[model samples]
Target: MRIAVISDIHGNVKALKAVLDDLAHQAPDAIVNLGDCVSGPLWPEETAVLLRDLGWPTVCGNHDRVVAAGNVPQDNRTDSFTEAALSAESLDWLRRLKPAIRFSDEIFLCHGTPRNDDAYLTEVIDGRGSARTADEADILHRLDGEKAGLICCGHSHLPRVTHLPASGQTVLNPGSVGLQAYSDATPTPHVMANHSPHARYALIEEIKGTWTFILRAIDYDWQSAAQTAAANSRPDWAHALATGRMQDGA
Candidate 1:
């Protein structure tokens, strides 16, 4: 089985379209969307419509839940923008999304941790209270003994593949398709950065019961993507979309 995975498409239709165009060529057996689908100042409605049409297996994300529940973060102006941008139908669809998906007996998909939609599955907070790569034992602890051949997750907006030599379970994060960088306060204030304006995703192919993975960062019209953010008064998101780097000191 070949699976194409995407996550954190925070309302940037341009980036999502670019990634989907690339996927058209790859023709993976299944396409999995890891959510955080539309919670930015960009084209939320358009992005939601496109995904609805594509009809892929999707899991709910933290941002999606906030919006679906009409609980936009108090400090997050982007969430307010998203709430207004999405239609009632789109919000309803997001509200009904599964928190996790078992694509097959071998493969599982989730936005964050399998148990907590908000928890980081393979990342952890450091002594500084900032998120960072987790140790093998820590990762395993978070897994809580759930064993699948492949566990796919997102939410840190960082692309990574970890093969637990002990469990033979591979955890893959496809990274962010939109919003390349953002500062978060959960698990302590920290920033997530891709460091380049590229649409990111991943392809996993099962070969003889083993897995081969490819991480993709496809270039798109990031300038326009940034411009949209700027136009909507989210210069922070604009900077990230343009350079994939947080605005200096942001």
Candidate 2:
């Protein structure tokens, strides 16, 4: 069986379409979306409509929850913009999404850690406001004793594949499809950058009880997306869209 995984769209339908085009050629048996579906300066309602039509198995991300709640703080421009742009129906769709999904006995899907949508799963924020790959002990602790052989999560927007040698379990993060780089200040001040503006996703296949996976980055018209962000008064998002880095030096 083969499954394609996408996450953290954060609007920007252009990137989503590019990923979809790539997936058409890849032709996986199933597709799953780890959310953060539409919360950015880009086309939230349009992206939400497209995702609703696709109807892929999806989980709610932190941004999804914030946008759906519509009680966004004034300082949260991303969620506030998304909340204002989304229709009532779209908000309802996000509200109905689950935080985690048991795809199968062997596969578990979640936006972040199974316990917390706002927490990082495979990475940790350091003292210098940067992200570092989490050690095995930390990763296992975050797993919280979930026994699925294959675990899939997103939130850090970094593409990674980790294997726990002791338990023979694997964790996969397909990365962000729309916005690739971002800065956060919740748990700590930190940034995540893919270092290039490319839409990302992952494909995993199970053969003879062994699971294999691939992380993909596909090129798209990021310049246009950046322009859209700038027009929406989010130069930070524009820079991330154009360069996949939070700033000039990042």
Candidate 3:
């Protein structure tokens, strides 16, 4: 079976459409969305409706939870922005999303780690402004008792494929579908950037019990997305969406 995975699309419908257009060319048996679907300064309602119609198997992310609760935390206003934009139906759908999906005994899907939706499944923060891969042992420890042969997760927005030789498990992070660069101060202040305005995702193929995956970062017209962000009083989002760079003045 071949599966295409997408994640972290924090509302930019332009990016979402670009991803869907790309998927149409690389058709797979199934598509799975790892959430954070609509919670940003971009087109939250439109993106939510699009995903609702697409009907891909999905799981909730941290932002989804905040939207469901209709409460913005201290640092981010995504919850409020999304709450105002999303319709009742869209909110209900996002609220009802499952935390995880076990496609089979061997395949599993989640927003972040199985145990923590906000946890970084595969990333380690190195300092005040960067994120990197965790140590192998650390990865294994965070993964803990997860025994799925193929584990798919997101939340960090960095595309990566890791094959753990110790447990014969392969983990794939398909990357962010919409927002490419973001600065988060959740656990600490840090930034993530793909360095280009690209729509990103991945494909996983299970052939004869062997799992192989590929990450794709495809270019898209992000100027429109940036315009929306700027209109929403979020020039930081505009700069990040347009350039995928974290500059102070953007």
Q: Pick the candidate with the highest TM-score.
A: 2
| Model 2 lDDT per residue over 26-127, tens place | 999999999999999999999999999999999999999988877898798999999999999999999999999999999999999999999998898989
Q: Model 2: clashing residue pairs?
A: none
Q: Give a tens-digit lDDT track for model 1, residues 129-207.
A: 4567788887888888778878999999999998888887899999999977888888777788878889999999988
Clashing pairs in 3: none
Ranking by lDDT: 2, 1, 3
Which stretches of candidate 1 lie above 4 Å from their native place?
Answer: 71-74, 127-131
Query: Where is model 2 more than 4 Å wrong at Cα?
Result: 248-250
Error of 3 at 175 (Å): 0.7
Instruction: Give the candidate order by descending TM-score.
Output: 2, 1, 3
lDDT scores for all predictions? 0.89, 0.94, 0.87
Among all windows of ten consecutive residues in candidate 1, which has the lowest summed lDDT?
124-133
Who is ahead in lDDT, 1 or 3? 1
Which candidate should be chosen as best, given lDDT against the real structure? 2
